[model samples]
Target: MIPERVLLTLDLPDEQASNQLGEDIAAALRIADVLLLSGDLGMGKSTLARAIIRAMAGNPELEVPSPTFTLVQAYPTRVPIQHYDLYRLGAPDELEELGFSEAIRDGAVLVEWPERAAEDMPKDAVRLSLSEKGQGRTVSIDAPVDFAERLQRSLLIRRFLDDAGWQHASRNFLVGDASTRAYESVCRSDGTAMILMNAPRRPDGPPIRDGKPYSRIAHLAESVTPFVAIAKVLRDAGFAAPQIPAADLDNGLLLVENLGTQGVLDAHGIPIAERYIASAELLARMHMHQWPQRIEIAPDAVHVVPAYDRVAMAIEIELLTDWYLPYVTGTPTGDEDRAEFAHVWEQMFDLLDDAEKTLVLRDYHSPNIIWREDRRGDDRVGIIDFQDAVIGPAAYDVASLAMDARVTISPELEAAAVDAYCATRARLGVFDREQFETAYAIMAAQRNTKIIGIFVRLDQRDGKPAYLKHLPRIREYLSRALAHPRLAPLVPIYRKAGIL
Candidate 1:
């Protein structure tokens, strides 16, 4: 029996509406998710399944034949989709012999004739019931509560796209990072593709420190306004931030230009030295410019960039005491140690008072950088995803690049990237190499410490254990940063925590 909870009951008045629903489902699909398509014969079940499979594969013309004789067809898309037809199943128990369980475990599954193996069919799978209504069909979707909300959001995205005049664009899931935002690539009829960013307003988490949420303390972007404002700022500075063509400011949806797929990393996911150097050069070029403290994202709409003050920086480092330390030491950090850690970090921040200040794109790392081979010089680097930018020391972003949080950079490459940045800055104008180096070491250490804690929190609180594997790299980066003589006083604290 289907549960009382029904996500949506809509009429697929035409093939277009039905195909749009299929695209929506594919966009919201997660790994190991199962979707049961149920309907009477000729209810367009196969057509909807083909629509879904093609959307997931990002190929509208990919051949998706019925899996009746073969019983199953698996396409190795990014999330991997498996199509199954059980209309001719001899017995319910035989479902297992067809590798049904294994297929469901590996990736998303779409099953037709689920009733043939009703006893063996997974109970938690989302169910779609379609029935003929005159010349069209109506569908009732029953999904788990959390998934139901996701579907509702996906439908909202469709409406947003429709309002933007791209009603029939093909959708494909791009990437959803460790943030609240999700992204999709929508291809128009003319073959132009754009990024559809689904960054809803960030809800505040429970007040963790100083009666403010972690996002507020960290100066994270709470709404799409920041992204729009920051994008304008970067583009005005001559950097290649994505051009936002359409924005539903109230709804947190945007259709942006598709920056090319190439990035600073190679096919093997390792950092390319030349691209890294070019990215560093881009940062140096950006730093030499004077950014407006308040940017006009739209006429009469201004966004003021927040200052990355000591409170925010210090509170960020406390993630070490609050999350990472306890995970490693088997004990919650004492208040005394927390106080000392905060104090040392505050003192380090004091050094930044004399350092040059610029727009610190809080995450100037590899994931957000797009490499354009066709572009010239610094234009080769495309910067995206910097809604949390702040007015801070010039060295912070340099540190973000040198001690990349996602991938390990060899010592030689790190030195080369840093030197390339220094050379670029020197040529741009008067540059203080010594001061920048001092701040780089301290800021790099501070950022790495916060990342180590965040990775642990992602594992423990967010149920994402994959981030744990990067902990060692983060720790090593932190140690390398702490080795700086200017940060010598803070080394003892790390040593006492057995994190050196």
Candidate 2:
């Protein structure tokens, strides 16, 4: 026998409580959701719907009237909502004429008196019931199993914001990169805006080798501790990491300052050479300093930066053979081929013996670098995505910028940026041009190899196909990097493997 589904119940002591609940739900609203609200007349369904529509529109004063007479009212909000009132319906078949199914296809739907047409509702539709209580009201939500956790998390964020003194802030979802973390832009009535980072602790996958997950071996930041520690350090060191206004470290939530919307890319999504050079110069200045391996989030909590050792680099390169090569050629790799690939990278790792080491922001690419024109000098480069930092070759970041992961970098522009970085380093101290040259090429190839596999894995395993569009660019970047004379030993290997 199957168990009965459990519904989440909440008590609303006043209109403010109901509004907050509605706002929280609105924040997590997605296209194709059917919010079936069931309740009697005067049970505050309209009030809750109004709050949700207003929150989604990002305008608290937006007019949202009852659709009782019209049958349905569509609002062009962030997630377009179709508000429906089946109370005065002539028949259940009228829902088809009212465009209920059509609304579900285009955007989210909120329906009152859904029981009038219960058969028309989708199986996955979220069910909400409102009823009167002692001097207040109670709401019970029964979401589809898959959506229940997301609803709880969004509500938790609402509570977090309220506790952090941001009760009046309006929320709008912010698109993030290919990561599990989510972001929201919260603005107050006075036009004060801040970013809310919802970074939950991700569980590790099954151990692939030596009883450790790839995340652990590759030194991926499992919690926000690295971010908090690095942000404080970057701010202290005269960089542009966002300020943390409030934090719930235990719950993996943080309210951060809003760095400008501008990034290293232009309006057309192309890399700006001038801005790239400026960012490179900033990196030069960063490498000149002797950064510590241990970063302090608080006096009691310290995060130790991991070293980018041969093991870590080798594991990353394996992605090419494990996922990317298989995807590109549509053939599973044999043990012999995998062993040869590992051998090639192992031999190439020795070229970095004399490479300069510093705090390597592993993903120092265009997407992570914000261009703040209002600031002067290095301050213009606002670094926001650096949780996966490591104590590694300084040349890695320069390569990451010059041979960007997401955008195409022309050879002329790449050379100019590298020249700017070298010039800036020369001005500060005696720079090792020869050593950096080889290290940059090796790091570039390794990064692209890993990226190629990650993109394939994202599409195949994670069900995100957008990253696949960048595979050709990544392949081109890899070929360019592999051309460096320092990597000649592995040239034939790449050619033989059909990955060149």
Candidate 3:
């Protein structure tokens, strides 16, 4: 007993408008959901289906031949989709011969002439009915119970846009990363563009310690407030973080300035030296500033920036023993071995007791950095993905920028970037290159080790296997960092863990 909770109607004045509507629906679709397109022959049903297929494939010119003749067609996109035309089916049971069940399990199902299936159609399927209305077409959408919430979310975006004075904005899906957050590019009627951040508050998982979830232990941002607070700090310091135009903090939504997609990486996806050097210099500049531990959200609201303390660091590295070691070795880690691992990390953490602490943007790499060529000096770099900002060792972000896990930063280039940062600090005041090098090496090893575990956890627990591809690169970074003499004490432990 699925309930029809929301019914939406739209008037498409032209084929362009119809196609845009199709794209919008495609963005809202998820795996296993069925979309039934109901319309009479030549009522633009196929045209809308083609638009959806093309949008999902991210190729405007993708060949999406109608399934009218073949009965079924599958497209391999980010989310695999099965397109079916039941118009020519001899009987409803013929769906079994066409692999309807398997198709639904694989990805989303788009069916034309679903009426032919009648009682055989899934009860939870979303139905869209189209009809000719003078010169334009009218569409009525009946969303099933499961889809009702998604429809609500879509309407929330519309409402947010209306409030932001961009009611007529067209949304284009943007790239998402290894977080719960998603984004879209909203193009206004005047051709101006902004970014919409959809970061729903995640419910806490099973308590890992003291009735607190792992996120609490890791000081992960539970709401959009941290992002807003951190962005303000960065922008006020003259950095290039996006300006928030409007925000629905309770809904975890924000319409922010669009920092163009010119990244620090080149055509080959490798880090460009000049941009990397600039990023390191930016980090140096940030380290010099005395950032506030707590940020003001509003007159009555304040966001306390968490310290990256020993407990947080220790919990992060536990991912190695908790997920990575077992994944790579095909065996669970022993309790004794886990104890030894913790002991090694505790000793390493002791060295950072008096290290220079500053606001560390945990993921300060090429992916989160936007290269604004028109801007000069530090402003040329636009930073994003800083919601997990912490008051920690300045070396952590430098390590993140240098030993970037996503892309291979050549040893020569890494050294040059490090040298540039050190040079900047030297020009400012007294700088200890040797002491900083030790901190850099230690942080790099710690960060890379954490990433190894995080990647494995993402694959095993989160069902995102794509991150596993970066493990080898991270392993190399860890090895290079562990080679530092100061980190020598933990060498045997790493070897024992089979990570070195």
> Which candidate leads in lDDT?
1
Clashing pairs in 2: none
For candidate 2, the clash count comes to 0
Candidate 3 regions exceeding 4 Å error are 1-21, 39-51, 57-77, 93-102, 129-144
Write candidate 3's Cα lDDT for 1-500 as tens digits.
56655788888888987777766777777899898999988788899889888878867689899899999999997678999999999999999999999988989999999999978888878888999999989988888766767766766786788898987677767877787888888886577999999888877989988888999999998889999999999999988899999998899999989888899999989789999999999899888999998899798668999999999999899999999999978999999999988898898899888788899999999889999999998788999999999999899999999999899988899998999999999888788788889889888988988999999999999999999999889988888899899999889988877777
TM-score of 3: 0.91
What local lDDT score does residue 331 receive in model 2, on the 0 to 100 scale?
92
Tens-digit lDDT track of model 1 for 26-97 = 877888788899999999899899989988888889999999998889999877888999998898888788
Write model 2 residue lDDT over 1-500, tens digit each, in one string: 43234589999889988887888898778889889898888889999999999888877789888888999999998889999998899899998998888899999999999988888788788889999999999999988765677788898998899899998677877765677888899987788999999988867978988999999999898888888888888888888899998988888899998889998888999888889999999999998887878987787879998999988998898888889878878899889989888887888898787788899999898888888888997688899879899999998999999999889999898899999999999999999898888998999999988898999999999878999998888878878889988899888877876767
Q: Which regions of candidate 1 are displaced past 4 Å? A: 1-4, 13-16, 61-63, 69-82, 91-107, 117-124
Model 2 residue 194 CA deviation in Å: 1.2
Candidate 1, position 330, lDDT: 92
